[model samples]
Target: MKWLLLSTLAVLLALAIAEGEVWEEDDHEVLIRSERGAKNQECRYAKGAWTECDSKTNQRSRMLTLKKGNATNCEPTKTMQKKCKKACRYEKGAWAECNPQGQMTRTDKIKAGSDSSCEQKREITKKCKTKMAKPTKGKKAARRNRN
Candidate 1:
């Protein structure tokens, strides 16, 4: 009886240690905060790229691939995805799309020939270019070192 009790306690201790109080994985932590839905539906956490898994007819599901931005490398389960769509809303403009690849430019850059509105196009192009410019050398170096 004494040996059995001791053995049981030892096993329990080992299990607790194995489970670990703090375990860190280099895996990306993806957080999808849906402004308008259920908690689980509004946010998803996965271990790889986002995969759209939908069975509902006429309903379009998005397979978002997030990198080091707001979203990470995790796919939300089908249920979670459904919840997220209902929750998320376009904060600005008609709609804003964010994916793992990056932001998509809807309007074409100011066309060169056939002159329609060069001034407006040029202004938009300049602003867009500046906004999308890469980080400075120092900031880039820091990012590289983080990995």
Candidate 2:
């Protein structure tokens, strides 16, 4: 009957409108950090934009929320992208994920042995400095005014 078809169409239209309204309210939260061992910063999503907050020194955090159907692929900004790709921590022998802007996700941390490499490099540089300084002084003294 014509009335039956009309009723069904109306129901479908109402359902579609309801679904759309719900989706507008849907929001997701994700936390981004600059490095591992840093505090787990918190980011909140409710409206449409991503907001980044720095609550701790030397740590960066961000929050993102997009439309229900939009992709959640958080991309880092240009400077952030390079900085994020920089090695953070190697976990289980694999690098952790970072935001598109290079800000670290909840998972990235300083790779093991990273600290040791810094220490070793410092020691080597110190030794090289001592050796280089000794030879440079002899040449400088020769050029100085003689008594």
Per-residue error at 53 for model 1, in Å?
40
Candidate 1 has a TM-score of: 0.15
lDDT of 2 by residue, 1-147 (tens): 999868965765466355431111123433332232234322223343323323344343333343222133323321110011122334432333444554432332345655332322111111111223446557568778463
Tens-digit lDDT string for candidate 1 (7-41): 96576545534643211123564444333222443
Query: What overall lDDT, based on C-alpha atoms, would model 2 receive against the true structure?
Result: 0.34
Highest lDDT among the candidates is held by which one?
Answer: 1
lDDT of every predicted structure (CA atoms): 0.38, 0.34
Any idea what lDDT model 1 has?
0.38
Report the C-alpha displacement of residue 44, candidate 2, in angstroms.
33
Residue runs of model 1 more than 4 Å from their true location after superposition: 22-147
Q: Give the deviation of candidate 1 from the true structure as CA RMSD.
A: 23.9
**TM accuracy, model 2:** 0.15
TM-score of each: 0.15, 0.15
